[model samples]
Target: MDNQKPSSGGTFKKFIIALVAIVILALGITGVVYYLRWFGPNVTDKQEYLYIHSEAGFNDVYQTIREQGIVKDTTTFLWAAHNMNYVGRVKPGKYRLKEGMSNRKLINMLASGAQEPVDLKFRGLRLKTQFAGYISKQIEPDSVAIISLLDSAKFVEQYGFTTENVYTMFMPNTYQMYWNTTSEQFFKRMYKEYENFWTPARKQLAAAINLTPIQVSILASVVDAEALHDDEMPTIAGLYLNRLKRGIKMEADPTVIFATGDFTIKRVLNKYLSTPSPYNTYRNTGLPPGPIMMPSVNAVKAVLNYKQHNYIYMCAKEDFSGYHNFATNVAEHMANAHRFQQALNERGIKK
Candidate 1:
């Protein structure tokens, strides 16, 4: 056995080796911590969306995330957010929280302001309030904001519309837009779509028919209201147009129902015709000041391409097939009306 006292130099060398090993271990652990903070999967399985309003701050966003538990290991996410400087760059949007997304990717997306879009859709809106309410549900603004914008005479004038007629500017369609769209922005987009729809050819057709775009929309709403089946729209539209050309009162029962504010009125009685409202076509000589409802594209086209006929009157068909009976004279119309009244009486649909 060659036993000898260990030299001081040898002892120091061992100590140095141990120190290097410790340093390497520490570096390995630190690397893992950093990687977990930045690159680890932070979005939880609870996969939901994150909706930040137009004017939200980081605190509001964080509070929502924290309260909703939208993420996993928020501790590491917070650290990464601070380190990556995402706290100062909060973007308002609808963010889809994808599963297995790392903190770095989420932070980058937020910082870069890349947000998902929303599909906004509406149809058969009978009133301006209904339109506003339906639109508000999918966007950041409230119904009050939409109603205020629609009611503002000055604001609507730029779009070549009056407060009463501005409702016609919005065509029923599925519009892909941002969730944070402001009310003004929504109106601007709708106006753009409206312009796109009313092309030069349609404009010429409207002019040839002696009706403005707003008037066409008004008539389309009435046509849509009277015809439950789309196939009957053209004939119904022609009948109303003929009535208009002949200077005949529309006597639209739908308008009477609208004026009464009783949407449940199954039968437009004589008393309901007396309802005092500008919307009551039974009293008004021409198209009402605004549309009774948001008109469909089909109904609108039906007005533009109305079937040429001598029909000046119409009533719902007696068979309840959602079709109408057309007439060129009041005697025929009265007979049709009597049949419809008899049907109504048999069905007990009295208001």
Candidate 2:
């Protein structure tokens, strides 16, 4: 009986040991499966990148980044990002990354901010038009809101602009800005760009010509409207400069057309020329209060470095090519005008 009892006790100890081994082995298998599924070969350890425009939602951003293979697991990435308090830090813009970037690194990049270049060309754009384009493509600010902000007199005091006109301040060029940049920041950056463009030499030239930078910009906008070819800009600018010096009304048909804000190439009727606007050069003398459109740098430079000439009048030649006939006297201008009119009549165009 004593031997049997000792044997029974050893058998019971063996059974307990076997049961503990089974449990430990099961746990190890479970741990291996979990690790394989969550952190194994499929896990992306490299960086990844994606681009998002302004006003893009966060979920859209997540999906984009995931599709770009920036994040290995969407759920895990989101969880980590959220846990690390990066929910608000992910700005809307082009983001660069590689697979396997740590969540911390991603978060830091997001927090550091991303900048994108916005090419706002001054290619014959008025202030309202430029602002409209800027709001549409880049900042997504409300048009009415931006206009109201521009119209507010306080902006002048805040920005140190002498003119009430907001369009006079923006220089047309390719500008770089953060994707999440505010409208205020955009305007501030534009002001800085304007300051940079208006260097001491440019200011001196503008003053020497008895024109403000804004006035030069306004004249450049007119030159941009009138001159079909870039090469003709300096000569055309000289014609207008002489006319201005002589205190003659520019009588530019382009200004009349620009006053209506219609770009049709049809003949300018007397009614169209009579359209009442401050921008109408036929109706008003000298430069308009501001630019009709954003002028190119070359056009602005053409106005600043205008050629010296006694020419006071210009008309498109009868050839209908892009060249113009410049005249110092009324008789020559009338002859050229008659020839152009004759050509227009032959083409069945009524002017």
Candidate 3:
């Protein structure tokens, strides 16, 4: 009976040891799993940004993460993502990935749809298509999609703009926006900006000048295209306004270049003057149908406060300086034109 008690006690001790060992092993495994799920650094130092597309699922996101070489362990990230319910909730945006970010932080940010906004700056765009192209480079919508909206007369008319003058609605400036902004959203945002730009004070100025807002924009575009120097814009605007007041043809060379669809024509030739388009200010009696190019805010303001001058004509200086020689009579303008023509001939810039 004593030997039987001893054997039973030994067996109980062995069972206790086995139970303790199993508990320790389980705790070790749980610690490792916990570290991987929430604490371990998943992002690598080499990674800078992560772009999650709108249609991306778990596999697509995983592939992108792997391709960027940011995650430390793909399997651990997958496990954490699956557990955190971040597998199917992929958000589309430009994400700034920081080094040493844990799976928990990364997954939480992505799941919450916290994406960085893109700074979109558009300047010097001449056509609506060009504006669309510029916007498409920064946003989710493609060029074709944006162009569809820009060209749709029915859609643009809702914003009180025609297909021809629709380009004026998008003022050129930097905007902070999300990357997934739709084309319609972008247009509305720009229209809002356009409205904000034409404040009551600006509207009063336009009324005082006897020009509508769009007309002011058109004239500003002409002035912008004509003057290479910003300081000379007011003078150029004054000359055009004088012509407008006298009921004379604006006879702007940029309009002819726009009509000809040839931006490379540095020297406006007589052949370009005969173009039959309404945009040909030499042939047309007043302003063109719309702006030839996107005008700057300074250019628009210059038109609002034009310089008061009696000079009725202008010709490019013969010295190749981007300055113009102003004239009150046809004889003086002819002299300036002859000098410029001679300079162009000397430089072999015919046609």
Instruction: Evaluate model 3: give its TM-score.
Output: 0.90
In the range 98-210, model 2's lDDT, one tens digit per residue, is 55556556666665664444554443465574565556565446566566667777875577553435676777676666555666777788888888999999999999989
Candidate number with the higher TM-score (2 or 3): 3
Give the per-residue lDDT digits (tens) of candidate 3, residues 1-351.
Answer: 445445788999999999999999999999998987788888998767787777778799899888879798988898889999997788878788999899999998888889899999987788778887878889989999999987899999999888787777777789999988888898889999999999999999989889989899999999999998899999999999999999999999999999999998998888889999989999999899899999998899999989999988999899988999999999999999999999999999887
Task: Estimate the TM-score of every prediction.
Answer: 0.95, 0.76, 0.90
lDDT comparing candidate 1 with the true structure: 0.90
lDDT of 1 by residue, 1-351 (tens): 989999999999999999999999999999998888888888876757888887888888788878888778888888888889888999898888888889999889888878889999888899999988989889989999999999999999999999998988989999999989999999999999999999999999999989999999999999999989888899988888888998988989999988988898887889888888999989888888898889999999999999999998888899999988889988999999999999999998877
After superposing candidate 3, which stretches have Cα over 4 Å from the reference? 1-26, 45-47, 67-70
Q: Is candidate 1 or candidate 2 better by TM-score?
A: 1
Ranking of all candidate structures by their TM-score, best first: 1, 3, 2
lDDT winner:
1
* Whole-model lDDT per candidate: 0.90, 0.75, 0.90
Superposed model 2: Cα runs more than 4 Å off? 1-73, 87-108, 111-122, 140-142, 160-164, 348-351
**Model 2: lowest-lDDT 10 consecutive positions:** 40-49
Among the numbered candidates, top TM-score falls to: 1
